[model samples]
Target chain A: MTSQLFSHDVQHTLDIAGIFVFALSGGLLAVRKNLDIFGIAMLAEATGLGGGVLRDLIIGAVPPAAFTDIGYFITPLAAAVVVFFLHPEVERINWTVQSLDALGLGLFAVTGTAKAHDYGLGAVASVALGVATAVGGGVIRDVLANEVPSLLRWDREIYAVPALAAAILVAVLIAAHALGPVTGTGAALVAFALRMLALRYGWR
Target chain B: MTSQLFSHDVQHTLDIAGIFVFALSGGLLAVRKNLDIFGIAMLAEATGLGGGVLRDLIIGAVPPAAFTDIGYFITPLAAAVVVFFLHPEVERINWTVQSLDALGLGLFAVTGTAKAHDYGLGAVASVALGVATAVGGGVIRDVLANEVPSLLRWDREIYAVPALAAAILVAVLIAAHALGPVTGTGAALVAFALRMLALRYGWR
Candidate 1:
């Protein structure tokens, strides 16, 4: 039971980190829009927690992580406050943020697929939820920023496709009972590299 | 069953009207942000359908209204397009837009309560969903506009409260087997009047 709890905590930590990166993206965009700190915080919270809350509620998890976990809620708030104070530095090192975002997307894609499967969803539905989890936050962030959702825009290169690949990897591993440490890390590495490559080469 | 379907259709029509008003509000706000047509359309869609889509998905409705009903998606697009072309008219009588917003809020509150009941949710949960439905679009709109969510702010008076009252009124009447022209219209009227008065006198 302690081992089980430890694993759950590890997964939750990854999810929280993913949400933080997503929130940072939203907060930075809010700054670009010349929003105040409060506005930045709101956008961060919306982009970071919105999709997970939606997914949890749909899956019959009540109260949502936004309401149940102060840690999750505070993570975005802290990220916003940091971005609030360090706008210039943030703007200068946006590349670092992008790298962290790619890492988050990969981890979150795996987490989402695994979570959906844990919720007893079939592999297909699990993969779909994984994609939703990975990209949903960004879609919402773009929509809130009053831009066409990058996910929906035809001009954007291979955004959702990388998330899909990650989800497929997890689904295949879980199906084969081969989601060992090496395989799990390999799957995440594949997703992270693919996303980074997509950003690098403008690959569609 | 025919009566039920008829009532559903009527509710759908009212929902369409609500979506129209909600879209108008979003479009106007996006204009204030100096966003382009695509940006305006994104805001309009977020404001018009975000709440209902959230409510439906929370209740395990798949694809969501904006995805399942082409009209729900198209309505906001059309409204945004109209606003893009007729900015002068929209600017001239913003008061009319506020009034329409009140009407939409009332309609959505009632419809959300009704739908929640149809799903056999408890009265409390139904009321929660109703409030969310009435305010969800605006929340999304404000988030996109980079403003603090009006519903969450104490400065906004009687937004969710009036919608809650309206939803409770409907739920009570339906429970009492006395839901008719009197209770239905009375609930909607009460909600609308409260919202209008809030708008006029600054009920916050």
Candidate 2:
């Protein structure tokens, strides 16, 4: 409400960027599952947009942006196409994909929080939605691929924590009327760093 | 509209009844998974409400009835309790549960389609939403429980087919100006009978 977090343009671009990387992960998983092309695309779209779509539905944003925005809808399909032909190469670059995925998680957590806040959800609910938005795609991907949600499995290294923390931080910043582009970027970076560190050190 | 399909009251009641049976399936799966009470409750709610929630979101019904209606929200919790305390007994009555589940599928298919139509969707989209509402919970339950969705598994008896057929029939009835309580009942009965026959005759 004050100066805002990310500019509308930056947020839109980042959202699409996040979808691209997340869809890559999903499409790669479909390859591992030996699914057909349709299956690969299904996983791509679900993994890329499931989180945001779920948040929008819960917060009363009808006809979610995934349906309305051609870019958002098409980016994941493009990723699917990329993986359809280059899965072996994509698989070879797993670390790079993971790094990009971490960035997507961070960006989505903060942006999703801001959007949920804009929709008038309370702080706790907003943070919850933010964390959900960050982790939802992966959960959907795993579920569709017939695996337990890695995000929820206790044996898995911590994943949702970083998003949760980032969302909480964003909520606090909002409460203080101190959320702006700089703080938002810092917040996202905090999430990214937490996720990378968790991966490296094997948190939980 | 030519005098419509169902009274809102009947639709509301049938919707809750469907939630009860679907939630039972979810609760049973959670028990099989050895999940704790919280997991049981989570699966129950997800299974009971996931489909309707998905449809509502797509059709622009914000804060879906699952959240707004206390009955819709609590019925699944009640189902979880039934499964929690009497799982062994419930399992013993598996055929009964399956039969009731088939009935729920039929009811939800018609009701979900009708609701989607009321929201001003086209016939195709309405039927699709109806089918989603009928099958959505089981998909979520299976996904959450980390198993392949039975509805999508080729080896399983034809599950989604019945719902799809019912929804299509409802759409036809709507188009023909013949959808009233009598025809609506006939459509739901058609779905239920088809599902039962499929299970009985090993249709897949």
Candidate 3:
């Protein structure tokens, strides 16, 4: 029971970290769009929780974890507050933001797939949800900002592709009865490397 | 049991009609935005179902009726096909579209509120979700087209306000144990008239 509890804590910690980075990116976008504090907070909350909310909703998880947990609810606001006060510094560290975003993407993609599988979805559906979980928040952010989502742009560098690969890896592992911590880590690492490489090469 | 079944059928039919009109508006927006055929279909689907999908997710309704019902899935595509072929005619009939949209909004707001009440959401949250069900699709449509949602624009005439009023009325009725077909229809009519008045008088 203690071992199980420890694993649960680790998962929760990772989930919160991913949400923070995603929220930071969202808050930064709100700043760039010249949105007021309310808008910044709204965008941050949406970006951090939108994907998971979507996933949970589709899987019949009511009230959503974000709504139930005060910590989850407040973390994105904290990110938004930081962006509101230090946007210029945030902008200056674009590389750091991008790196964090990549990490979030990798983590979400695998976790989303695993959760979908737990919910009894097929591999294809799980993969789709996984990608949605990874990128859905950004789509919501861009939409609220009245801009084309970078994910759907023809000229945008590869983003969803790497996430898709990670989701697929997790799904395949589950199918082969080989899903475990090592494989999950390997899947995330692969997606992270691909995202970083795409960023470095300006892959379109 | 038979009466309950009959009311359910009536509600279902009304919901489908609302979705059709909403989908038509989404398809028209895609055409105006110069998106391709695929984009048109996607936008149509998103606009038609986005609200209910969000509502269902929040209420813990799994798989979403939109995904489960074949008619719901196909209606938007059909609307997209029509818009693609007769966009000029659709443009010419913009007033008709607007009127239908108003009708759809009223119907959706009341139905959404009732559904939320059935799902055990409190009055305040139910009213919020009701407005969301009425306006969420259009917001998604605008966002995908890279435009500010007219519903959120300060200059735009009243849209969500009338829906909110209707939703509030439903909540009050539910609270008073007076919710019925008469009250529901009356609420919708009130909202519908308000919307039309706003359009005609250019209410800001």
Off by over 4 Å in 2: A1-50, A57-114, A120-131, A144-146, A151-204, B1-4, B62-64, B67-71, B122-125, B144-146
Q: Backbone clashes in each candidate structure, one number apiece?
A: 1, 0, 0
The number of residue pairs in model 1 that clash at the backbone is 1
lDDT of 1 by residue, A1-204 (tens): 111312767767877888898899988988887766766876788788877876676556654555445577678988899899998898889888888888888877777777777778899998899888888888877766677888887787777888889889989988887775567657777888998899899886
In candidate 1, which residue ranges exceed 4 Å CA deviation? A1-6, B1-135, B140-204
What lDDT would each prediction earn against the true structure?
0.79, 0.87, 0.84
Top-down DockQ ranking: 3, 2, 1
lDDT of 2 by residue, B55-150 (tens): 987887766667556678779989999998999999999999999999999999998898898889999999999999999999988878878789
Please write out the lDDT profile of model 3 over residues A9-71, one tens digit for every residue. Answer: 777887898899999999988888888989999999999999999888786666778899888
Error of 3 at B91 (Å): 11
The numbered model that scores best in DockQ is 3
Per-residue lDDT tens digits for candidate 2, residues A80-136, read 999999999999998899999999999999998888888776676677678879988
Question: Comparing to the true complex, what docking class would candidate 2 get?
Answer: incorrect
Candidate 3 residue-wise lDDT at B42: 66
Which candidate leads in lDDT? 2
Q: Per-residue error at B107 for model 2, in Å?
A: 0.9
